[model samples]
Target: MITHIFNSSIVSGPEMLVIPALKKLGEAVSIIFLTETRLPTESARPIEYAMKFGYDVYSVPVNGRWDKTAFLELRNVLDKISPRIIHAHDVKASLYLQQAKRVRPGFKGAIVSTHHGASYRKGKIRLYEEIYVRFVLPSFDKVLCVCELDRKSVIHRGVPEGKVSIHLNGTDRPRVLPEDRNASAATIRKSWKEKMPELPDTDAAVFLGAVARLSPEKRHDRMLKVVASFKKREESGHCKKTVLLCFGEGPEEQKLRQLARTLQLEDRVFFMGYSNTISDEMAGFDALLCLSDGEGIPINLLEAGWAATPVISTRVGGIPDLINSNEAGFLVEKKASDESIAEQMWNMLQNTKQLTSVGQAYQKRVMEFFSHDAWLKKLNEVYATLPGKI
Candidate 1:
């Protein structure tokens, strides 16, 4: 049995990658997902999806405090299950498991951790992450990183090179019928048009968009500045008609909206809040614009490519591994200036034929490298090598 522990049941990139891989592992494999946050809808999509594929599901009431009682409860459950392997999905969960093992040390299973992103990049969180790596990381039998870039980052911060492994995140290529895609596109376009009627119906009305939680690291402010600069160029007759669509919501939504208004981009930009069907929405866009400060291979980029939409992204995190400038997609430098983003946008807009060709190449690359089956095969290999596994 393989048991996975996480901090929340809310939908995110890592959950999407892990759940689908677990489902493909077949019914003989016992899987358990433990999360502290309860699903608001009661219809937890991850749990429901896992159950549909015949995996045992469990939800324990875990308080916010990661105290001795929490550790004891987790250890007690581990004792009952006697799982062959325990895999913690994030830093907090990994630390909790490490603490639980210290109190109850007889657990014979191998402990593994998959570090999803760079926690150190977020101000004082770096200090906490340094401490965790120094103290808690060595306790795990193995540490896994979601991408090669992350593996290097962890190793640089004190994880032994030999103890770390790289496993790229994966996605299932959803069966997108032509009619379905067209319908989805129409729905998305209609909603955006309703919100911003000034948008033209001409092909010149290029949709440049992104889908990510509105956070400081996502650099939505930087993206908005880029759009503002583009709008300036358009007004000056140096660029053509374009629109920017931002999907997903977080604490920074209001701040980003304010920034848009300050830049006089109120008419040219639209914030579509959080939408569950982001993949369907990507179809309406001419290209995806991702300007994150960091990431571990965003699944949305892969999804967009799978849908044959080209990407314009910052050269950060594991993105470089998935995209090649002007080949698979365009790569802008990190924290790029407004002028740089504007130039790239203009270049892409001017070369429609080139953009389409690159997007097609990107679609083929995703099929070859990021498929659900590829993820399952790699994970099964890791599972087979774990200590105490059957």
Candidate 2:
């Protein structure tokens, strides 16, 4: 058996990929290896969801990072399943995997980790991240990064070069894009309204998009300020009707909303919080905005790319690799200011005529490279070799 472990993350970026990746794995190997998901206690909903996908799901009753008892509890589960490969998605699980390995010296199962994002955090969280990267991650049999930036970060910090690999998240299968994308923009707009009632009944000519956990790294403040400046600079037309709707939530929500009000953009900017159906919401956006200070490959960009939505994002983490060429999407420097990003947003609006073609081209890139088949193939190879391998 192969086992995948995670914290209580649900309906979010990397966690969302688990089921589909597993499903693809099943198909690829003719269901040769059985797979299971091990989650912490009180993660009933996540366990239930995984069970629906036919993964043997277990909840080990972990109380938090301080819970030492979970290590032995998890070891018991490991003893029962004897998973050939135990892949961890967070710091705590990796620690448990190490403990389980140390105690069972006879165990030959591999321990692997996926460093999902290089997010910017502070204080206790930052300290934890430091420990996770500097200490725990290096011990894993294999460490898969979602982008090259993360792989380089770990290597520079002393993770052996051979242990790291870059693996982009797989996107859902592409759909046949409408030939006249301009005419079909409203179709996406309509889906947005149906999924989210907070949106106005009428669709706007421009829908500026932002989807990420509201945090300093995500720089949602940049998104709001850009919308404010974009509207202030444009005399009329789409600017008058443009709406910058942000999805995802965090401790920074109140701060971002207050910043919007202070910038006199409260009416133009709206926060939609977290959405389980974010994939459905991407198409509604005319242009997706990403200006995070740190990142791996963001789940938002992949979803937007899958939907064929144009993006105005900063070159960070694995983004430059994904948005490698101008034809795929628009990119700004990591240090781009609100004014600079605002200009990009305005330029995109001005050329609204080309939005559909540009978005379609971007979607093509996502399909060609980030498809599930590719992700599954990469995963199987890693799993097969990771036993006493990297």
Candidate 3:
């Protein structure tokens, strides 16, 4: 069995790949929940979902980041399942998989990990990642990267180029959108005004949505500036009002709100905080925005493409794969300044027919090329070529 290791808390992009993998791979896969707490409470979403698939789900708790003893405990669990592959989704699990080999010398399973993407995490998290990139990652027989940029990043750090493989992220298309597009959008707009009383009338407003954690890497402030620029155009009677609804919460919430206030976009920008209905609500907006400084084949963009929601995103990471070549949607050209990208967002709203055509092309690309079956086939191929043989 291929035992997948997920050490995640919230259900985000990783689930976009993992949940379907569990369902598709079925009995061929099991799961090892490596948790920092006693009950693996941090990973409740994945654990509960994996159990529904009837796979063997093992929850092993490491006392803390410094716990080498955790690997000894893992050996007890490994002895029972004896999975030939231990595939980790994060740096911490990948590091411990390396340590598990040191503690249990007889173990011969192949070690594999998925490098999601690079991000600007600081403090102890950053330190651990530095070690993980430089040391622990080299020990893995295979390192699956979500994008070419990530493959280049790891190989440049010392991992053999042969060991790294690029697997662009994919998604299952959301079941067909509600039949009445106008009614669905009206419903979404009505629901938003009811929940967020502070929001201005959105019926005629060009609604733009951003779905991401309010983290520094997401660069929400850039989105706020776009709205501020739109407000300036509106004041000069040059454009319609644009409202930005930011979903997901993080440590940077207050900071972003302060910047919004500073830019005088209080009425134009609305913080939706955290919402589970991001996929459903996103269909109402004119377009979705992804302003991250770094990314992989981000699941949100994939969902946007499938939902037929045109996206205006920074040209970073694997986004060009989705937008360019096909001319599927808007792209803020490389190394463009904050002012330039703000203009990109501005230009996206200038034409309505272009939005529908671009969104349809993006939808076509996602449906034809980025399917669950295609992703799993690549994953299975990666598993087949691992250096360790059972």
Q: Whose TM-score is greatest here?
A: 3
Where is model 1 more than 4 Å wrong at Cα?
27-54, 175-188, 191-204, 238-240, 387-390
Q: CA lDDT of each candidate?
A: 0.74, 0.72, 0.78
Query: TM-scores of the models, in the given order?
Result: 0.89, 0.88, 0.91
RMSD of 2: 3.9
The most accurate candidate by lDDT is 3
Pairs of residues at least 3 apart in sequence or in different chains that clash in candidate 2: none
The parts of candidate 2 lying over 4 Å away from their true place are 27-42, 119-121, 173-176, 180-184, 191-203, 236-240, 387-390
lDDT of 1 by residue, 278-342 (tens): 76567677789888878778889888877777888888888887885568988988866768877
Clashes of 3: 0
Supply candidate 1's per-residue lDDT for 264: 87
Q: On a 0 to 1 TM-score scale, where does candidate 2 land against the true structure?
A: 0.88
Per-residue error for 6 in candidate 3, Å, reads 1.8
- Candidate 1 differs from the real structure by a C-alpha RMSD in angstroms, to one decimal, of 3.1
Better of 1 and 2 by lDDT: 1
Write the number of the candidate with greater lDDT, choosing between 1 and 3.
3
